[model samples]
Target: MTEFDLIVFGGGTGNRVASAAAEAGMETALIEKGPIGGLCLNRGCNPSKMLIQHATVANRVREASRFGIDASIDDVHFRGFVREVNDELAAVADRKAQDKRDQVNLTLFQEEARFVDDRTIELVESGETHTGEEVVVASGSTPVVPDSIDGIDEVDFLTSADALRLETSPERLVVLGGGYIAAELGYYFDAFGTDVALIDRNETLLHREDADVARAFTEVAEERHDVYTGHSATAVDESNGEFVVTAETEEGGSVEVTGDELLVVLGRRPNTDGVGLDATNIETDDRGFVATDDRLRTSVDGVWAMGDVAGNAMFKHTGDYEGEIVVDNVVHDAGREVDFTALPHAVFTEPQVAAVGRTEAELDKSGTEYVVGRAAFTDTAMSRALKLDRGFVKVLCDLESRAVVGCHVFGHEASILVHEAVPAVRYGLTVDDLANTLLHAHPALSKLVQKACADAVDAADRTTE
Candidate 1:
């Protein structure tokens, strides 16, 4: 049996933790089942954004006629686009792996790891036993494929993993989920001249978002794709070379959608099961996600769980943030706890969506008194100059304390503008505090946020008067 100061179960975010431990003078080992760089770099965010950016260029030129510019997308060369992103990501993974292998104090185990006991693991491929004084599981997550849909088992379908790797855009693409992944890739293909259809059980495309924002996005999405909301996919079948999906409509009738390819973005499951969690004292919730304290330490002593496996937050930025906390607490013995008071989420689809802090539904469910404010992008000089037709910025603040609790945006660069709301939400700035303190340049998207906040404040002042 080989022993190390620390053994990490994944090389994805574990790469960061392992490197930090080694730098802090502890010998570390990182075991990975897949390639280095993990989901975010290889499959999820980076590569998806790469394709999305190209599609954005195509979409911009296609819409440029609105600005009186003669612009058109002659050819997408989609196969070359996929190849470029994939090859670049692969090179990145290779470089990171080689760098880890070169580290004197960090050993890279290019294999799967399963728990032997509470403090030990077996490298599955080599049958090697390894022990650690401290252990961390950053194994991340995998796409969820349900077997409930009849005939789905036999048909060839693509998930987000496969969608990002396609060299050729399908003649017609059918998407199975209405969340961020489905919205993003569905829009991307639509921009590239591929016929796209979206079928979702939810009534809105981004069901988690506020009703107005969700409605706005669905409206925009409908303009570009065949959107079948409130439809649940029941089964998949193939006729000739095309794929057919039978779904149950909201009104209880059956409908069929035919497409050249099917892309499933229903959801993701944590990579906790089959990881030997049963062998350890590590407790998991009903969803198989590791149950961790605020500090991110697993129930097992000297063990920590983070990223998707821990079920705290699923974003890449969340993983990196928690990884830093884990490194500080374990390596430096800092005793730092995670406070996700202002974590932000963004979907990079056209007319991007972003949100920070508690959603209005949560506030209503809790019976929390709040203020609502809204501003449309069309009211802004910049949006008018750009001839942008849609988008809104909204803010909610506590009625008594005047603290801004939530903010949501739907517009161009909404992802970037959402960050401005983060500090206000995190630090508990009031509507008046934000509206009065911040200086937004004229004709800039930043002013939209201040306008929303000022709207709320003005409404409150009127009520008082």
Candidate 2:
């Protein structure tokens, strides 16, 4: 038996927590079954974004003639682009993983770890039992391939994970689901000159966003691909090397959609079952997510869980925050609670959508009195000069306190622009504070954020008068 002060299962963000513990002079060990950087760095966010950037640049060149620039793209060369991006991202993740392994005085086990008892885990590689004074589980989630649809097992399909490693572009692609993954990949394939058909059960895509924002994105999506909303996929079958997707709409009409390949992006399920949780006293929710309190502590003593496995927010940024919270509580003995309020998220679509804090519907449901300020990018001098049209920024603020309650943006570089408002909302900065703040560079996209804030203050004043 190998005894340590702490042992963390799953490398992802758990690597950070284990490193923090080891730096504090605690004996620690990290166990990872897959690549050390986990899904986000290796397969999910980093690689996907790199591929999307290629498509974006290609699209820009294709439309360069609109700006009186005669730029012609000879070929997309998608396979070459994907290979380069994947290789670069994998190298970075590998280096970071190795650095963590080298710096910390911790044992790195490249094998599956199963909980043997309340405070012990068995590393399957050496069949060694390691007991820790404290344990942290950060095992992440995997894509969910629903069992309800028939013939899906026989048909050739791709998940976001597989799509990232595609060697050749499909002549026609069918994507199922309305989430960010589906939208992004569908857009990517379409921009690469593939015929894309996107199907979702919801009435509008990105249903979690504001209605107006969702509508604007859907319009952009429809321009390049066939978008079928309010339709549920009933079955998927293969015919002569092609996939046939049968869907029934809310109106009770049957529609058949076919393509060279199908990519399902329904959702992800937490990787919690059969990993020895049943052998221990660890508690899990009905959906198999490890149950944890605000402090990221599991039900059992001397054990904690974070990231996708803990069933908090599933985003990569959320996982990073959870890792920090766990480290603070375990190391510094700080009992800081997790605050999800004003947490930010962005969807990397054509017209990128970024949001922080509450939505109009959420505020209305809570009966919070608020005022809204909105400004269109099309109204800006920069937008006119660049001939970029589509999307706007809307700011919501509390009427009484004048504090910014929420900020939502959809348009060029919206993801980057939303970072400016994060501090304002997080620190309860009032609309007056934003309006009076100095904004540099008149032609920059940031001016739109400033304009939106000023417009919001002006709207509040009119309502009061």
Candidate 3:
């Protein structure tokens, strides 16, 4: 048995906590079965965005005709392009691992770890036992393939990770699920000239997004791919070198989609089961996520859980935020609550979607009174110059406090533009505060935000009158 000052399971955001402790002169053990950077770097955000950039460039070239520029894509070199992305990412992972190994007080365990007790862990491959004064389980998440789908085990289906690593675009693709992962991956292949069909149980793609944004995105997606909303995938099977998916619609009709490849993007499941939490008597939510207090501490003393395993927001940025909180509490005993206020997320698809804070649906359901402000891209000079036909920004402000509660945007550079509202939502800034701050650049996309804030201020004034 070996003893360490700190032990962290999963090298995702947990790497941050472990590195911090090691730098503090405490012996730290980081057990990561895969690469050091975790899912975001290995398979989730980094790889997906890198590959999506190729799609984005291809799309821009294809759409250049609208700007009166004679642009054409001679060839995509899809296989070589994917290989380059993978090679670059693999090199990054290698560098990360080597850096961690070089850390004076950090031991990088490239092997699986399971809890033997509250503070004891057993390395699976080495059959070695290690105990620590403090432990953090940041086991992240895995892609969920619904067992409810008949023959799901029979037909080989590509997960979000597999889809990102594809060397060649499929002739035709069938995508099951309609959340952000589904939207992003399906759009990538479609932009690469794949015949993509998306099926979802909800009435619209990105149904979790604001209703207006979802509706608008679905309309645009339908123009690019065969979108079958309100349809739940029932079964999958492969025959004669093609895969077929059968789904049941809300109206009780059956629809079958056949494609060269089937991509499943149902969602992600917590890796709670992989870690031996049962031995420690640590509490888990009904959905099997490690239940933690606001400080991210688990039921066991000196133990913490963060990231996807804690069942908070599953984005990499969220995990990073939570990681910082955990380290502060563990090292400095800061006792700070994990503040997810104005947590932002972006979908990297065409006409990208981005949002922060509460959604209109949540406010309405909670019976919270709020006023909305809206602005379309067509109303902006920059958008007109770029020939952008669709996209808009929607902001919701509390009726009483007049502070921005939620902001949703859909447009070119939506991801970047959404930051204008993030500080407002985070600091409880009012619409007037945003609109009256400064002179926005003329004929810029940011004017869309300025216009929306102005509209919000007007809406609030009307509410008082």
Candidate 4:
């Protein structure tokens, strides 16, 4: 038994927590069963975004005629492009993992860790065990493949992780689900000249986002791809080396679609079970997510959990914040709690969608008094000059405090533009504060933010008068 001050399970965000402990002169050990950077750096966001960037460039070249440019795409060379991006990102994650292993007074266990008791975990490597104290579980999540669909197992299927590593592009690809992953990959394949058919149970794509934004997104995608909504996939089968998907329509009609491959982006399940939590005092919710308090502490004493396993917001940024909160409580003796208010999220589609804080629908459901102001990118000078007029920014403000309650954007660089409003909403900055600030460089995308704030203030003043 080699006891330590902290032993973190899962190397993704757990590495951050372990570093904090070791930096505080506490003995820390990190146990990982997979790559060091976890899903975000290894398979999820980083690699996906890298491929998306390549697709973006390819798209620009393909449509260069619209801009009066004679640029032509001789060859997509998707395999080589994907290989370069994944290989480069994997190298970076590996280097960071190694640096953490060497820089701190922490031992790295390249094996699975199971909780043996409330305050101890047994690191298992090839059926051998090593003991530790003060354990932290951050073992992330995996793509969920539902077992109800008939013949789903007959044909070869790909999840986002496996799809990212694909060297060959299928001639016809069928994507199930309308979430961010499906939308992104669907768009990428369509841009790469692969015939894509997107099937979803819901009537619109991106059901989690604002309805108008979802409609706009689906409209753009439909222009170049096949979209089937309000239909349920009843079964999937293979016919002569092709996948045949049978879907029952909302009106009780049957529809059959066929493709070369199927990509299931339905959802993800937390990777909490089978880690020997049943043998310890750690409690998991009915959904199999690890239960944690406001301080991110598990039911078991001296044991904490974060990231996908913690079961709050499943974003990487949220996981990073949780890591910091756990450090504050465990090391600095601070009772600092994690506040999820004003958390930002984005979907990197053609017309990007970025959102922070509350939505109008949420406010309406809660019967809260709030006002919304919207400005279209089409109305902006920069958007006109660039011929990019696909989305808008809508701001929600509290009626009493006149402070920014929420901000949602759908358009070019929405992900980058949304960050400016994050601090404003997090700190409860008033619309007047934003209106008075001198934003730099006219005819820029950021001017849209400034103008939106000014318009919000103007509307508020009119209502008062």
Each candidate's lDDT (Cα)? 0.90, 0.87, 0.91, 0.84
Query: Of the pair 1 and 4, which is ahead by TM-score?
Result: 1
Candidate 1 residue lDDT tens string, 69-130 = 99866676788879999999999999999999998799999987899798899988899999
Highest lDDT scorer: 3
Candidate 3 residue pairs that clash: none
Q: Give per-model TM-scores.
A: 0.98, 0.95, 0.98, 0.95
Candidate 3 lDDT tens digits, 166-274: 8989999999989999899988898888999999999999998899999999999999999999999998989997998999986789999999899999989899887
* Model 4 per-residue lDDT tens digits across residues 1-465: 777888888899888888888989889888887778899998899998888888888887877888898988777788898898889988987887787779668888777778666656676665545555677889899888777789887778889998888887889998888889998898778778789998899988887777667777888878877889887788999878788888888789888988988899999888877677888888999989999999888887788889999889889999999989988988776988889988999998777888888887888898877767778899988898778857888888787788998888889999988887888899999878877778557887877776778788887887777
lDDT of 1 at 372: 87
- The stretch of ten residues in a row with the least summed lDDT in candidate 2 is 96-105
Residue 362, model 2: Cα distance from true site in angstroms = 1.4
Reference-based TM-score, model 2: 0.95
Stretches of candidate 3 exceeding 4 Å from the true structure: none
17-126 per-residue lDDT for model 2 (tens digits): 88899899889988888888898988798988888888888888988999999998887788888899888887887886787778757888878878888888898878
Instruction: Quantify how close model 3 is to the true structure by its C-alpha RMSD in Å.
Output: 1.1
* TM-score for candidate 4, residues paired by index: 0.95
Ranking by lDDT: 3, 1, 2, 4
